[model samples]
Target: MKIGVLMKQVPDTETKIRIKDDASGIVVDGIKWVMNPYDEYAVEEALRIKEKKAGSTVTIISMGPKRSVETIRTGLAMGADSGILIDDPALEGADCYATAKALAKVMEPENFDLILCGKQAIDDDSAQVPQMVAEFLGMPQAMVIDKLVVSDDGKKATCYRRIEGGAKEVLEVDLPAIVAAEKGLNEPRYASLPGIMKAKSKPFKEINLGALGLKAEEVGAKGAKLKVKKYFLPAEKAPGKIIPGEPEDAARALVKMLREEAKVV
Candidate 1:
């Protein structure tokens, strides 16, 4: 089986984001980057699948600036067989559709039997790329799946998708389908010392638009239909008010505030 896992590099969740002065984007100068937390589950799931199927290979694929290589290397250390990084100046600011287009273009020739990715990247939280990639490749896709079972012959995949009310929707799709992994799918493993060392020797390929057979106008900012007009932080919340009196008095005060000041009653 050949499995391809889509990966993304995003700002660490704990990092404090600051919008750019011109509102074009976030300030990246001092931000620490890490693999999208959701993608970690996808990587772990891919590794598990590879272990169960002999002669299987897991490849990590990503699109971003040069710094994204670190994210791919992290996946390599997590036991993916190889890594492919799509890096090009023209790919900067590529929106979800363009990103999916570029990734689909790259993977079509590889002919992977299965594709997996996180439900969403944390940075933008768009949650659109994986489905778009599946559409571009003309493959069926199951999103936010928490459970997966591949057939013994590796010709089909059964996925359990979590929906509202804690219900799971079971879907079975033929081979060469895409799945967007959600949290609770599996716990991601840390890179072992030996694994890290071996990752350095693993096959890693970096390609650009030209290599992907994509024209400059077909990707990146030029190809993006979505545009960020401006970014602004949410308005600061007011401090809470404390009603300190008898319980009965406090209850009455709270009710008053709810009905009058807050006007929610």
Candidate 2:
């Protein structure tokens, strides 16, 4: 079995974000970057699958700027066999569609039996790329899966997914399908010293748009069907009001406020 994991580098969730002066985008100068948290879950699942299947290899695939190589290396340290980084200026501001197209191109030759990725990237939270990649490859896609069991022959997969109203859905999909992993699937492991050292020599390949036979105008900001007109921080929330009075009076006042001022009742 050959499994492909789609990874992404994103700003650390704890980092404070700043908007650019011109309101065009977020300030990246002082931000710390790390693997998208959900992507880590995908990588861990891929490693688990590789362990169960003989003669199996897990490949990490990503598209981002130059620094994305570091993110790929992190996956290598997590036990992925190799890494492929698609770094090019033309993909700077590409939308989900353009990114899926580029990634689909890179994945064509590999012909993986299964592809896994996070449900969404934290930065934009679009939750669209993996499904789009499946569509491009003409394969079935199972989204937001929390549990997965591959057949002994590696020809099919049974997946468990969470749904609305606290229900779960079980699905069976053929091999060579896309699966978007959700949280609670499994806990990710940290890379040890030896794994980190081995990652340095792992098979890592970097490719550009031209190398993938993609045109400059067909990807990145140029090919994006959606564009960000401006980016501004949301307005600060107002402080809570405290009613100072007797308990019974306060309760009456709160109900009055809810019925009148807040109008929530």
User: Which residue pairs does candidate 1 place in steric collision?
Assistant: none
Local accuracy of candidate 1 as per-residue lDDT tens digits, 224-259: 988878999999899989999999999999999999
Model 2 lDDT on a 0 to 1 scale? 0.95
Query: Which 10 residues in a row give candidate 2 its minimum summed lDDT?
Result: 215-224
Write down the lDDT that model 1 would get.
Answer: 0.94
The parts of candidate 2 lying over 4 Å away from their true place are 239-265
Q: How high is each candidate's TM-score?
A: 0.92, 0.91
After superposition of all CA atoms, the RMSD between model 1 and the true structure is: 2.4
